[model samples]
Target: MDKKNLKDESILNHDDYKDQHGAVVPPLYQNSLFTFDSWDSIDQAFDHKTEAFIYSRILNPTVKVAEDKIAALCRGEKAKLCASGIAAITSAILHCVRAGDHIVTIKNIYGPTNKFINSYLKTKFNISSTFVDGRDVAEFENAIQENTTLIYLESPASLTMELQDLKAIAQLAQSRNIKTVIDNTWASPIFQKPLTMGIDIEVHSASKYLGGHSDVVAGVIISNKEILDSILMAEHELLGAKMAPFEGWLILRSLRTLPIRMRALMDNTMAVAKFLENDERVGKVNYPGLESFEQYDLGQNQMTGYGCLLSFELLTKDIEKIKQFVDSLQLFSLGVSWGGHDSLVYAPIISYLKELSPEQFDAMGINASLIRISVGLEHTDDLVADLHQALSRIA
Candidate 1:
């Protein structure tokens, strides 16, 4: 178990833990704790001074493999895996903000993130927050306070697909001496690299794309070495929200095929987005890939690829007709998460409205009949036929 004696430190490696059978994939280390050869070794691990993983709660060989691959994907100094996407996000926010700290964030990020900041932190901690339109750098500048410690953002902001200029925002946050964090889950580090733009930190809901099979629910934080260490101490070790070894194994398998899966997913997405845009029944398809999108140029400037998620409101606002359309779909599954081989559809009016205030809803134009689709690896022709039939149901 000596680090200096290792031959290769590839993403597929589990340090030097060689199986007697010479297996290609590392064997899952499912036990809760590891035995020490001597009393000094145990002391070294507990002291936060040793790289040796002593407990599954803190670290495991299988989980470490996934973490290493994620870190490499993000081009980060380090990475930490968590139980769920919220675990990764909440931990990063809580770790960065102490009581009385202020946060300025984009209006439409992931719903759970909005709830965590507006509801949970507002009630328990004295952290203050201001939500703004991130598409305008001036809004971010205007929202900053003397106490502002963090600036959080999500580009192609959740369902609405509003684009943010990451490089400009990062520069603004840097000049203000404020920390910058972003949810890069939508682009999956395949199409966008936030860290390279001078952003301080990036996070992902590994449950969606990283797992790629709709099986494991996991999260990750990719950032500088110092910030990761701080989060590891506060949220990871103290809260005991580490990913299970078995789940880690599944994610590793998914990571191996991520590149190919993402290529096919994007191709399907482009095809589907075009089909939705051209349809007479569809209104305001919110995909950056389309030249008709308001921020299409901005998205093209920052993102290397058009991602797999898009939302559109029906020309008809009847809720009953919308339900019929959703229920009639064959290829796309009705579910919450995506990045699997199977496509998914969800109504934000059903879940997202519960979190937004009446005034916010009015300002944002919360279309009751809107539909969001997470494109998958399905053949484009078949997926289009499934969607066309669903639209026919509504008519």
Candidate 2:
């Protein structure tokens, strides 16, 4: 099948399941290893003379189906599925650098990812990194050193929802021979295609939007075959973070409804963002969909749709007031992580007050009163009412 000619919905729903005995869904191959009928078959599999699954950790029929679907959706040559989002992220990062290599990354990247680059790689691998604001392509360009081998990014970054100019940065990185990797978890393949914009690799925490029900924890790395082949042998297989068959099946199920869910979430979130923006008690709404956003034009150019995740600052900077507003929201469950069916609220101050220095907080535009919301599949009126009543508490 020519995936390039198909729409995302078609790719997600039907791309990899056609050969599965007319089954509506792909069947899960739950075993740990595939046995060969003859010694010659085993030798052929080992030598890559024939396509065969030898071990579950290396490859599984079920996981490959999910990988193929995601790769097609992202318009990438191949994909590697991992046990968790961090696994995919770390694997991709590892594949791009060696000892003494430097990385330029966004200041407000995902928390675990920030830690991995700043702490783990720095202390263990002798690797170094610089954090850029990511709003300006020049920030990335200025950070590149002779040793810089990778430029990592998270557009609509973490809490502040800041965006990077993907095309500009990609061009900059390519010119400098630096690999560009973007965490596309916020947009998913449905909204953004970083690969199409010349990014070297696209990473996702499938636990978020891809596993929309929040039941599965998985991650995927999408890129050309050459890059993925190297990672598949080195960081992916050697690191032993392959996605399980059951988890792959769950991700496949979620793919079927991805387009529908994303569109609905976008609509619901836009309504919620507008409500907060108009409310007197809300300080600044940090959703890219809002015209008032600083990077609204850039977001429109790069992304097809603004996603469900958004953050807003309360008019007051008091922690107590922020807590009251958050606690008042009966519909939004206070927690970390977003992009699921249930609405969630996370207060960065509650968790990061002690974890981050004052300068770090300033750099990321995070504050005590900032509240992040992940809008779900609920009716727009109910979500708006929930926000209305929650804002009333702060008022």
Candidate 3:
């Protein structure tokens, strides 16, 4: 069946095994191991010839259901559930890049991801990477070397909200036989599908939109069977970063409401973005929905909806003034992370990188006046009103 039908017909509507009570929701199979009827049955399962659970580390019925749902959502042949988004990203890269291999990445990727490749991976595995401004696909091509094994990117990058051309980059990677992976957390499958543009693999922090409520912390790596097997065989089993059964169940439950939640959040976000754009205190708004945005045409072409997350730089790069603005907001909470029912506001503090000097901060796009706001499910009028009061106090 086609992907949309697979999602709507089987994956979305499908239910896990239930007890005699006929409970609709899947119960958490939280056991570490399952008992086998016989040695023959165990042997068959070990040989991959039967559908039986040997151990939770290797497989769990609940986790498998969630993996299948996300795999379908990503339009990949297979998917693997991981303890966290970083685990998925780490495993995916490690599985492909051996010692002496190289990777090219967009500069504005998540801070931890940058650390992993540049610092952690380099020290431990002798792997090296080049960071480039991925807004220009040529930068990726220019950075590629003989040993370049992978290209990693996060479009509409988390803090900067910069959009990358997935199709162009995927095609370039294809010619060089290099694998491509994207952190699709910002624009969930509801907004963008990387696989359709020929990306080799897709990764997500299910902790964000996929989990929806910010209650669960999980990650997913979706790819074809070949890459999935190599990853699972190489590090997935040995590293033991698998998601728990109950966490997987929670993600499955979250999937049903993803479309609805995303729609509401986008509606709220569009209104808020417009409010910020019109405000004189806000010097610049970085939302794809805004007509004045640099990549507005590309966003309209590639994304289904302008995502709920956006960033803005204030007219005055005053730290105390920015903090006061954020603090005065009664509706928005000052915290980390997004894709929750409650709105969050993050100032351009040093929470991203500890040793990042003032020079480094200037090198990156962030400044003291810049702040990232994640629009939640709150009413648009209330959110706008709160933002108005906060900005009014700034002057």
TM-score of each: 0.93, 0.97, 0.95
Task: Pick out the ten consecutive residues of candidate 1 with the lowest summed lDDT.
Answer: 4-13
For residue 88, model 3's alpha carbon misses the true position, in angstroms, by 1.0
Best by lDDT: 2
Q: What RMSD, rounded to one decimal, does every model reach? A: 3.5, 1.6, 2.0
| Model 1 per-residue lDDT at 52 | 63
Residue 185 C-alpha lDDT in model 2:
93
Clash pairs for candidate 2: none
Query: In candidate 1, what are the lDDT values of residues 141-189, reduced to their tens digit?
Result: 9999999999998887768888889999999999999999999888877
Candidate 3 lDDT for residue 281: 79
Question: Per-residue CA lDDT of candidate 3, range 111-228, in tens?
Answer: 8899999999999989999999888888999999999999998988988888889999999999999999999889888788899999998998888888888899899999998888
Off by over 4 Å in 1: 1-20, 48-50, 353-360
Clashing pairs for predicted structure model 3, backbone only: none
The candidate that achieves the highest TM-score relative to the unseen native structure:
2
Cα displacement (Å) at residue 102, model 2: 0.7
